[model samples]
Target: MNFDKTELSDEELSRYSRQILLSDINYDGQLKLAQSHAVIFGLGGLGSPVSLYLAAAGVGKLTLVDFDSVDDSNLQRQIVHREANIGQAKVDSAKQNLQALNRHIQIATLNHSLDEAELLTLMESADIAIDCTDNFSSRFAINQACLQAKKPLVSGAAIRWEGQLTTYDFRQDNSPCYACLYKPGSHQELTCSQNGVLSPIVGMVGSMQSLEAVKALLGLPTLMGKLMILDGYTLQIRTLNLKKDTHCPVCQAQS
Candidate 1:
């Protein structure tokens, strides 16, 4: 992607003036962000904030995948949709909201569950894949697809007052896949519907995921093999360095 500094018009300059103020993201960085594309799974709580922030930050293309529709319970954290959006596909609502947030961005909607085949197609065009789904099935599928595609996967989860963020860059050889941290179908887990989640916690984690995605796109250092855990009640954040499990099923198979 070629970036010409003079191509930014006065309107774009004013629009991204605040981002340009940051030394980390000047004209060059903004151009990189504008040229990059991301695929986000799930358009619920975590996905709502992730997509919103990414779109607002002027990512060139965003592809949203979700099989669900708007419900009354989603209004608390799914800020992309409203009361009128009930029964409407979440991806459709998210596309409309994202475009409204940034007209310069291109929005694509996939109103279907991400099976393995669809995952590969999405990752082919995406610079990064974000896992915001609440279930392990979808998360594991995303991880395997990212690993096969050699793409960076930014995964985030939030429940109640706790949130977690991690990056699995399979291109790095030793980075841990999502299955390395948690085995799929090995143990039972609760979903947001069963366990419930705090509204703001979803936003917090989703925003962090967006930040990591931007950093990865800009070639900035990020949490490639580390897990960040946030505690809303104590307001404490912990970073745990995770090593690639040589005996792990997924990573071992890949090796």
Candidate 2:
């Protein structure tokens, strides 16, 4: 549950009545979700579903950061953006769509690139950070910021027929950051623009990220320290244990 007591209005109660009926997430869990704030980076394929689901599920506030604009090619997997918004900034387009989905939720947009300090500053105010970026550089920066801010991070990635999802809860001493999994300069980044990802692959990963984010906010079990890999070609999903790197430059000192 959230630290402060958050009351749900009659309208909110009605809107979230379906989820509230779950045994695991009753009224209290809904309240906790309503009090949580999530910062999402990249408004592309993975971010589309993550932001939409979080807003519809009643996450109180969302800070959307993306420097790119919606493109004709993005419509293939970026469901949150429409053809009409092709020239508009991704963050602005996403914010508009999210507001339409849940008027009660607050949505903020950052349509420019963020440096290390800017990312850290944004993470400090967020309860959790969601990384839907497609590049390694962006992912590394987000990982470092979340680690320093001590905020949980729900990260998802997809390319071609493969996708991966994981969580790093910086509030925990044993949680492994993205750096623990991939050394900063060792791995090459893949992009859908070049590799061509299947639409549903990104959707699957993003949806799971939304679920993990809600679970993290409600103090429930999440994908923390576990990497969930999906092979869209064979439709096989596997979970692997993610260990902390003792020499990780990002989280080793914190540990």
Candidate 3:
């Protein structure tokens, strides 16, 4: 999906008037967002808000990827899917909802997983990639692809009253990849299904992912080299500086 127009239409200007009012994101910023493309993986809890806000915020193009079908259990946190879409593929459901939210944006859907090569090809035109995946394996794969592609990636995870958010802006020489923080197959993988997640926790993290994606596109400050940890139980947030892992196989090779 490509949006070639460099200017925002009157309708788009009105639709995103509030966002454009911000000094950091004036008309020029809104125009930039209107011409940007975002690729989102995993249309689940985090994806729900990320896609919704991006669409409503007037990102020109979006690529939604998810292979799972909507289940009854998903209605609680996956706000993008409705009860009627229970048996439908998540990407299809998300596309329907996102299109309905902002008809001006162009949206594409991929109802299957992508290999590293495929991921790189898909991200060729993407301004940013958002990782809403819950599993560590998917995170590791996405990180590697983004690193190779040299595209910015916004990564988020939430489970059991805890949430984490970060960005791996692979375009920068000093940006750290996800592998720098967690070694593959070393930390136990946790899922929302296995350990209950507070519905709002995902919403919070997903919303932040949307923010970071837009910031990255506009060349604004973001969590590019920082990790944010949220404790829903204590309602506390912590931000940690991330250093490039001198020994990280994934990023060290690129460096």
lDDT of each: 0.86, 0.91, 0.92
The residue-level lDDT of candidate 1 at 91 comes to: 94
lDDT of 2 by residue, 1-255 (tens): 235645999999999999999989999888888888899998999999999999999998899999999989899999999988989999989998888889998898998899998998999988999999988999989999999999999999999999999999999989999999999789877778888989999999999999999988888899888999999999999999998988888776665
Worst 10 residues of 1 by lDDT: 1-10
lDDT of 3 by residue, 144-221 (tens): 888888999999999989999998888899998999999988998888898999999999999999999999999998
List model 1 lDDT by residue over 1-255, tens digit each. 223333666776788889988899999788888888899998999898889899988788898989898999999899878888888899988888778788887888888776789788779777898999988888888898898888999999988789999998876988988888897678787678888888999989999999999998888888988999999889899999978888888887777
List candidate 2 segments past 4 Å from native.
1-5
Residue pairs whose backbone atoms clash in candidate 2: none
Q: What does candidate 2 score on TM?
A: 0.96
Q: Considering summed lDDT, which 10 consecutive residues are worst modelled in model 3?
A: 1-10
Candidate 2 at residue 184, lDDT? 75
Give the Å shift of residue 216 in candidate 1: 0.7
Better of 1 and 3 by TM-score: 3
TM-score of decoy 3: 0.98
Residue pairs in collision within model 3: none
How many clashing pairs per prediction, in order? 0, 0, 0
Off by over 4 Å in 1: 1-6
Error in Å for residue 232 of model 3: 0.9
